[model samples]
Target chain A: MLPYGLVTIEDRVARLLTELPPNPQFPTQGATLFVDLARRQVRQAYTPRRIIETFLAGRGANMFYLYRLLDESLDPIDPSVPLIFGSGVLTGIVPSAARGNATSWSPESGVLMDSNAGDYFPSFLKMNGIDHLVIYGRADAWTVLWLGDGQVEFRDATPYLGLDNIDMRDRIATDLGGTWTRDLAMANITRAGENQVLTSAIMAGPKACYARGGPGAKMGSLKMKAIVVQGQTHDFETAQPYKQYNKEIATKLLNTSVVKNALRTMGTPFLYRPSRVLGAMGTKNNQETTWTDRLDAENITPYRPGMAGCFRCPVNCRPLNQLNDDQADRYGRGDGPEYVTLGKFGPNVGIDQVEPVIRLNNICNDLGLDTASTGSAIAWAMELYQRGIVSKSDTGGLELTWGDAELVERLLFAMSHREGFGNVLADSTRAIERGHYPTEARKYCMAVKGLMQSDPHDARILKAFALGLAVSTRGMDHLRNRVTLEINARINDDPGFKAKLYGGPVSAQPNNYETKERAVRVCENIYGVGDAVGMCRFTTKLFNSPSLPGLEEFSSQIANVTGLEFDADVLDRIGLNIMGVERLINHRLGVRRSDDTLPDRWFDEEITVGAYKTEKIDRQEFDAMLSRFYAISGLSDEGVPAEAWRQELELVLSGPA
Target chain B: MSITVRLPTTLQTSGQDSLTITEPVENIAELVRVLRRQLPGFPAQWDDSMLNFSVNDEVVLHRAEERVLASGDVVEIILALSGGTPVPRSAC
Candidate 1:
């Protein structure tokens, strides 16, 4: 009785077939998949050209789609909450364009949110001729959605239940295709998601994940376990222009020494050396700001298996590591121990040893827990214990001590399973702030708007970074609005260049408060565009490298790949519009000017050690900066988008629900 | 003035992370000059503009020549790249 003509071999399984109408503008020709698991209904329809044109792809598309799906009546944790998957238009066709986005209402933040990942999943999604996938409604039983050969299959995921992400992917691939399935990609969750932990991540490919904003919890709420994709590859190399363009980009990436020597050779651990010396990282749960080099990248080189990249990426910045040490050997091999992981599990918890950090990262990856949040949660508890706020009696007879790697690992598992004291950690900082010691412990928890400020870097001195983190829609995320160039002394000293870039004199000094709002605004715009297009920030100009691609390159690539005439200004506007849309969604969720603020510790506590010792956010300066940012972002003094912004965003949101 | 000069792994050639510059250097520019003279393997192409000189954890962001250094100062010379280790910016 399905409208699209369902075919059923068994009463439990259902399939819907539909024809795609050709649209010259869309590369996918408006291919969209809609699945309602509660009703066991599936439908395929042409995505409106207006939606594609206005939103573009990836997060840009998600912003509009998520906004439309979200209503005042819809609870953030409702089982019917829409989970969206989208890819950039240029994905699979261009280098460094393989990143994908998953959008849903964050159960933790109580707001619409999206997290991105880089891997074969996005490429396979695009190659399989599906540009956008939307799944909603709770299934009667655990289900896995298989996308391949221009069709979708609903497979019972009961057998895959309770399996880790890696196991689930391997088993699903073997069951659906084979051991050597070609071009098969999988995104799955683990025990953490099954337990509905707020910090769970959707593991894409082997290591990449849409980790932020708790997208895995949304997937779990729908009784979904994994999504498997197998698609035919497109040979754009046959086209001479496309081939030459890809070569040009690949050559540029290789030519950049940062990419070749530092990023590719050492991966994200390359930042460890700088962060250690510069005192950029938060140590011991923001109580300290410096750590020794025991956890340096050079120490990790021995265990690194090899470098891996997403789809057509040339940078290959991820190191697929194999732990060699006796303690870490049991966790087995996995990707990452990214810089954030190094800081979060290492210095943040006072664990200087490299192996323990790797073990912690691997455990999080295996259990589908976010290392940032997990580390933060444990660090918060340790600090609470240190301050004598909590004791062994309250912790189920477990002493929360700093540098206790064994306890950290055990707590990660406990948090995943919501066991004992780990249940408190799994509920996020807000729950603890309100439920536990509201006054004494709240000051110690470094969270903004319920989401833990995951970046291990202390932002007290990094004024632009602090401002960016404060105003980020998803709450306290670095990638959204970090003006990395603020720390580059060479760039900062060049007044003319700075003025041209930011439209004003933005200081290069990390502690300077003047003109930072301008820099933050510009960075917000660039990141908006970057996220929309699914470009990894590391591969873009945002990463303090002039050689990497930015708006100009993206504009040209979009033209070459999609035949769309989206100039840099248009892209900038689209990014800006996406920001406005996100703010509007949050506004509807009761977010106000008060919500656009940082943690109390950022302003109250001074960094004990570092080059920027005694540095903290000046309340007046931060307030002024926030006001300026709002003014420039076309928002009212109260943090609401002005009428002009509303009209412009409404124009984009006006087309086809 | 005996100053401690710490070099990043990428810049080190003497198989050491740090060296003692016993020579008197008034500012970061002079310190760089002394470094180039003392360390034979120091890249001659590097200039004050290319490096971030942090004196006792305080970064000399503008006009390194004007920022005065004192005896017993710990000078950490890192690359201008904010997110990564020291590398020649010209290669980009």
Candidate 2:
């Protein structure tokens, strides 16, 4: 293993060895393990050019590295490609919203699932003396890695199988002092991971989770149970020159209006009203305008829940609430009931009661299910009930009525256990569509490219969001790119002024589509930069925080931390490099543009209410948007990576073609 | 005469203790003019510019040129656009 730093890895390991009782669970082959330093790969000497290049290239670079380590012949479904957990140079050190990213050829969209779960991996890995950990090859038995001080101890955790996420978290917390914050440690999978359900997620925090692409199931299939890394409190260190830079950035972030207003006050639940007004909040399986009168009925407004935040994030968006009734005993009081969960579980299912929604949120959390997908599935069932397709008999005498909290809670239980009709629902809308409801299944699935869609919002209303969803590697996810802010700002402020800036006919009032192609390109770059730096998108988009402006600054931070110098362009190259490599992997696995498609209902039926009332997204327009997106992204017309882009990124162009 | 304005849950904590704010009024426009004096920094206006008004739970369509308000009427001003966080429209 490489030397740790002012404190060498060997010395740190020896210190840890002295503290813990001798246990055989520690890996015997310590020589094979090594820390791959990422500081040199992320720093830069120049500023302006490096900043742009880093934004353009960082995401691809990470993807390329991950692809090289995986089997090229296997598809995303083959369970061979390794899930690479990465942290950017800014992680652990920079106090803004730096986070960790998970990159893998997804089983959900058969593309790259580049997602940020929370701050645990970023901060923990930094303290453990590393920036990224490429976890490859399946273990023969269920195992867990305890990354602490300087050494990584691999323990056989087979006995902990079948435990829920909450139980796993509780057990881990108890085992390693109850004071260990959830932001510092994460339990990837519990019972749901063991089941290997495609829709399963790796639950984090009290309510935060990496929900898309079944990473939890992937862990189960590999027989890898969980990995917990705890950072030492005294690990914060900074070299000369760059120490002042870090302090200045933190000061600017605290004073920014974006941090004080947009995120701090509303949290993520703020998306509900705008989405509902725009007719994007999917209701009744995207078949109706509104779900219930619950937005007003439940009094679900934003309120502070004391001091709750991720590893160094100032914008504490997670709202904590106390339940003083009988349900509080069974379900512990903690964070969340975010907009997506509340919208899908409450209003979308025809219920407006906040209490039941909270209960359902807790149930999904303990069971380790993706609330977005679970709620979407329930909404689909509700639609099925309304259409007379599913009745009391299908639901085992449970009335699938709208606004029935009791039935909603029961369904959540059934879905998690895979009991009764829950077996069919557990397989996800994609699988369900392919099985029983082939002809009409796509209508209710509300997915794009096989991954289930997030909270309801019509892409057509906001062109940037629509295009982002269309071209997103992992189906209809929004975090991949968020250009909706620009669109929203324009509409909310001055339509005429925005129209001029966007460059189109002022009288025509071109919808989000007019500038979608360009907006999506920029958004992709922004997302790439955020992922590479280990920063949350909300920090940039919502809080308006500026990251390292150029490579010199990035390198300065890295040089101070890891004593390494890297070109800024190298960081930008990382994002594209990762995306190109993942696309190549997907192509080998047989994922194509034809596979990237929205639900049929979006194209066929007209929305009857809200901003997009009486409008339906034209398939032709959507196709045009995708074509433009792919072309700009350096992908071929067929949505495959072009040979030039792949060659430039140093990824092997050889694949299905 | 006077009209009372009810604050939504989000704005209840803004030192507006009572459920309703009473102000003298003539018409929707005049009532808003009166409210500006009553509640400073209230982020709303009463121009015939697509303003939606409700009196005692019933929607009132007021023309910019002709609409008028009477005493003892409970008037609620609804912003055309909504969502994000939970800040009041005036605060936004």
- Candidate achieving the largest DockQ: 1
lDDT of 2 by residue, B15-75 (tens): 6623343545566656556555665434322211212345554433212212466666666
Candidate 2 off by > 4 Å: A1-62, A72-79, A182-184, A235-243, A291-293, A296-298, A301-304, A325-328, A388-399, A433-439, A486-512, A542-582, A651-657, B1-92
The Cα error of candidate 2 at residue A44, in Å, is: 24
Q: Judged by lDDT against the true structure, how good is candidate 1?
A: 0.75
lDDT of 2 at A422: 71
Q: Which stretches of model 1 miss by more than 4 angstroms?
A: A1-24, A28-30, A178-182, A236-240, A325-329, A433-440, B1-4, B13-25, B33-51, B70-73, B79-92
Q: What is model 2's DockQ versus the real complex?
A: 0.09
What residue pairs are clashing in model 1? Answer: A611-B57
Residue-wise lDDT of candidate 1 within A140-250, one digit each (tens)?
999988887867888899999999876777687678764322477888889888888888899986668888878788899899998888765675422124667778777
> What do the candidate models score in CA lDDT, each in turn?
0.75, 0.56
Q: Fraction of true inter-chain Cα contacts (below 8 Å) kept per model?
A: 0.25, 0.01
